[model samples]
Target chain A: MKDTALLSAPLQVQDLTVSYGGDPVLTGADLTVPEGEMTAIIGPNGAGKSTLLKSALGLVKPLSGTITAWDQPLAAQRDRIAYVPQRASVDWDFPTTVLEVALMGLYRQLGLLRRTRPHHRDKALACLDRVGMSDLADRQIGQLSGGQQQRVFLARALAQEAELYLLDEPFAGVDAATEAAIITVLHGLRDAGKTVLCVHHDLSTVPRYFDHVCLLNRHTVAQGPTATTFTDANLMRTYDGRLPTAA
Target chain B: MSEFIALSLPPMLIGTLAAMACALPGNFLLLRRQSLIGDAISHTVLPGIVVAFLLTGSLAALPMMLGAAAAALLAVVLIELIRRFGRVEPGAAMGVVFTTMFAAGVLLLEQTDTASVHLDVEHALYGNLESLIWLDGFVPGALTDPQALATLPPELTRMALTLAVIALALWIFWRPLALATFDNGFAQSLGLPVTTLSLGLVVCAAMAAVAAFDAVGSIIVIAMFICPPASARLMTNDLKHQIAWSLAFAALSATLGYVLAGYGPLWLGAEASVSAAGMIATVSGLILGGTALAGPHRKA
Candidate 1:
């Protein structure tokens, strides 16, 4: 049973040690994401939540670690995964439209030479519609509000059609409506048998938004289903007894 | 007509072609906020030319261009090394490497006996655009004669070929280029070679700068690489329109600037013409300023 569980896991990171500028950000961290579930990695301000997420996607270099996705190395599983980095990672003033940003999701499939056609446009449009952003398809990315920009990013990731979704704080700095819509889409993805892992803030929403939780403070404090693992004890341990919450 | 073809046609066409070539990759470079890389590459090409002149003991085109290309690549490598190992920011590293290389080139120029050649700091800064005359173009209907074309300045042919290659590369890698420029981290996650693409962009810029350095000066190379694309960036919110606008602005700057430099003084009763390269750079900056004033998407 244990072997079957390991084989079926969507993402597994063992002994990840990452440092930035000679300062260790993550030290001996391990994570195993449950397949087809919404898993949240929550921790305090300096807990390396973002680092762990980026290291999994090969965006951050790991000092000593092995990252596997669906029982294979992360490199081999790149096409099978979609990553939604923080919205602040890109320059909002870049000259691209919403539809164009969404079409970015099809680049790996289009390879280097294949042109985008009508079907690809329709697919990207459908993703925008799923996020209630189909009307803003022609608008420049810089014109969108914070919540709208967050939705546009989610729409792009949805257009990827991947088996695993890794997001970095997708709900941060968004309106309540956008948050609800995003969570609904994420839950739908989980129900459709796609693995969803995200670096989440707002301890108040952990039990409500995520089905599984990994309480992390540099290292994995506890990880399991929300019912058994997201207790007050784990919350205090993750936040260092701060009892902080986000609206 | 013959005078126009022999004297005016070559430089004007060469200036236009060179402008368009640099502006093409300049679109992507501007978007990536690495516009100064063009400045650095153009400056570094100077030392390369001096070195090539030193080694070849002649003003041959091919060897000088090869040397320029090598130096441009070396400048890029040095900047990366400093940024990586020296733990310095990219801007500071670029400033250090390009300036040092350029200063060395100037020193090398002063040290070498180049009295016989048209090589000097002034010539490199303001090119011999007035001297790129095509005497073969003086023959009647020489425009249609293959023999006449054979005697044409090689800089014109080299610039045309360089422009074609840069255009083809941009066309082929449009999507990936846009993705990499917009968000490199996302591109990496998709298994795209973002690093290779970034390096390829620098290589393309270096190629344009080297080719253009022969006819136009470093001033126009750096100016064309930044000004046209930057002006176009304010004109449109779509990448396609941005590229198209940049090319149009580049052509406009080259033609108008070259024409004004060549004849505006003649019309004003002056005996000598001004530097066409400097005029082109001025015109490009003027266009950028115009766009900033009234372009539709000029706001941040």
Candidate 2:
């Protein structure tokens, strides 16, 4: 039993039900994300894609569910998880620099009142370099372009040094170069044997970007390898819209 | 020269310290976009002060401060309750809670024989800085003498100690406070005690409000809690620079306001100066307005 549990998927959610103001957003949602793969959670608007990710991260409490990472409770494995929230969730005009936002990822390790040491700064800079944001480290975050801001958030998540990365709409509103840069980083993370789950919107690039796909609409429609599970039927079922002729 | 020093120095020092105390926490409050909480706390603390006086029959600082802190916390709790259970907007909840509390305080004051207590509604709303006199004659050598410390008015000592405590708290909790204010969701996910830290900040703000209540009045405390920090926020995009600028702006407003209140009347041919607390608030507002106008980072 222990061996099988250890070999189970890196993330598992069973019978998850979540609601806001008594309105059910997701019901009976079950998902399993394998390790060492880039998994994209694809769904239509108001389809509970963000809600699923938030509930899995424990940002939003589910009405009923069991979510485990590596068969352990989220509380026990919190440090091993890194989350990048959507851009709209933050106050862009806040008084902080790109470097400062990236450094916030270290706050969990450094704890309260402790200054960031030299090693932490080196690590943060390296993370910035990873996302091509090293040149603009000292610039104020509010002054950055949308893509640059997204890259900064990626840098901050990189600074977390976690084994699992959860991102929400990382490609939304980003330019082509930023999207490619982010995909390269995701591939690097995947090759490193880390799990990456993203709430992605662009359907045309889903197959090229992700190896695993979870199609959802209020609940899981299908979840498996991208080639096997990302079908037109599943897409139509998830989106409730007519399937496109191409791709 | 001696008489002028005796008359002006104590109030100026008091104003500066009070402004500093209020501004320190004001920075965090402004960043959190909860600046109105300061206004709510200042107004709600009035009933606490009145009830403390009625209970103790003496205008002691410590008990009154404790009462005011409790009342401020109660106001926050009430606002939350209204926001949650009543399903009211946060701003509306704050307005409902603070106005009701302030009215209750006024009713309490009218019902009690507070004349013997040396506290009244007017003094609670707008403090009497003119009466804060250093009765003990100043000795030039008293600056360094330990005995001379005892000669200072209790209000000045209280303000000084409050300023020191506020500064120390900011220095010690700077990281957690900043993280929590900047991104509360991230802070919570990191296992930081975000709620406790927020409560601690609110309590500190309440303490500063209570400490300054006797010298600067609730109105000036409210002004100090919003204006200087807001001006500082407009001037900088770095937290450390913002804090330093906030302190500088606060001190400048206090000193400039005192001088303008005391000396500006002479230029207008009036023999006496107006209220120092009112002037301090005015100067702080002017600074905020000016920074909003000229600040490079001011939003379009």
Candidate 3:
């Protein structure tokens, strides 16, 4: 908890709650994402991790409280944040290519009536290259494997060039090699002074990959460095210790 | 044989042109899952035409048509506003806006003897193809050859031009439109004017529906707008491919439906004229049904 006070907060969510059709999914949740680190939100199923991230990005409406990004309201300053929704949320059968989906990250910048400039296209390709997905740029989205689709979404988020990134379950169902590739890219981004918040599973890999961890279950169970807050006690509280607590 | 030619050519040409026009905007709407919005606006345009007629004292093509276009555009804007501010479901918002506008139009038509004035709401629904010949013509002095110079009716011509404009607009803004349709939040984060883009798409769809009203009637125009693109979607997952295939199917359906309307009943030895619009829809439906049935269900 001492490390949490030392880290500079980039996103501050205060008393945020979300509901779908009047059934509350997240209740009175509060957490701060520190600047220039990879923070993994780990919790059991239905822990409201996804809802918290969505609320922080202003994607989901909060019943009460507010989210401030870089000391400003999220709505007034949208360009600073970019969100990568779960791969499952999209209709993969949608009529678009990998490069096109990546290019869509620039839609907020280039706009509706305007065309994607040569520079934008070049940047999109560069982001794809960062994810090692340049070869599949022309392929349609439905033609992609699960890991490949996740990488494409990562490329899209990277293309945003925003100060903060929010990714929902980017590692679900991906292979080891793809995970390594993604982590490598994410680590580089983190080192470059960008904040990356991922709603991650696989608690075993948290100590190796993330510098900070938020153990949440409807509310913040613990928040600190991976070594400090990711102890057996926190694991029990977060996931009820289904696996070995020391993983 | 000549009688067949005489009765069939007008409906064929009109239906083909209208169906083709509707397909252009319908492709995008179907992709966006808002195809039913087209049906709502089409029915809503009747009162607009009636009002336009009341002010002008005749169904003077320009004013009446412009009124219909404006009303349809209003319906789209209202639907958008409700979705944004009311936080209502998009489908429900469309239903509310269109139904209200259409009901208003119906009331106005009934109050005003609009039918005798040639701006009838009934004719707007089941368009009389036989009368289209009397109403149809071309730009008088614009043609080099007297025969090829024949133009469609002023209303249909305007509708065709409006469709061309919408098609051109879609071409110019295809990438943003595609991106927005897929993920609106991403588009907004990138600094795109998402509201404007969405509104523009709805307006374009409304324009297409207005143009389509004179040929196929409002009820069936929905099929023209939804079927080809939906069928095309089943065949491919590329936007360009979908649009191209939809256009091809739309043209093919128009030709087949036109020919069927002319000869299907005669071939069956019945004294009846096949509904060209209905047949066009049926053909497109068959194409979609066949695609759905035969498509590979497992991951390719």
Per-prediction TM-score: 0.95, 0.94, 0.80
* Comparison by lDDT, 1 against 3, better one: 1
Best by lDDT: 1
Misplaced by over 4 Å in model 3 are: A1-8, A21-23, A75-77, A113-122, A235-247, B1-13, B39-114, B117-125, B134-152, B191-196, B267-272, B287-300
Residue ranges of candidate 2 with Cα displaced over 4 Å: A1-7, A241-247, B73-88
Alpha-carbon error at B106 in model 1, in Å?
Answer: 1.8
For each candidate, the alpha-carbon lDDT, in order, equals: 0.90, 0.87, 0.76
lDDT of 3 by residue, B1-300 (tens): 434333455566667667767787788778677787667667778778777878888655577568887787787799899999999998898888878887787778777775564455665665554455522233233334445445535554665687688888988888777777787665554556667887888777767666666556675577778887877887777788888878887877877876776579999998886666667778878877877777442235
Better of 1 and 2 by DockQ: 1
DockQ of each candidate's interface versus the true one? 0.88, 0.66, 0.40
Docking class of 1: high
* Maximum-DockQ candidate: 1
Clashing pairs in 2: none
Q: What is the C-alpha RMSD of each candidate to the true structure, in Å?
A: 2.1, 2.4, 5.1
The residue-by-residue lDDT of candidate 3 on A54-125, one tens digit each, is 778766678888788777777766777878888887778788899998887776677547666789889999
Cα lDDT of model 1 by residue, B153-245, tens digit = 888889999999999998898888899999898999998888999989998998898888868888999999999999999999989999999
**Where is model 1 chain A poorest over a 10-residue stretch in terms of lDDT?**
A1-10
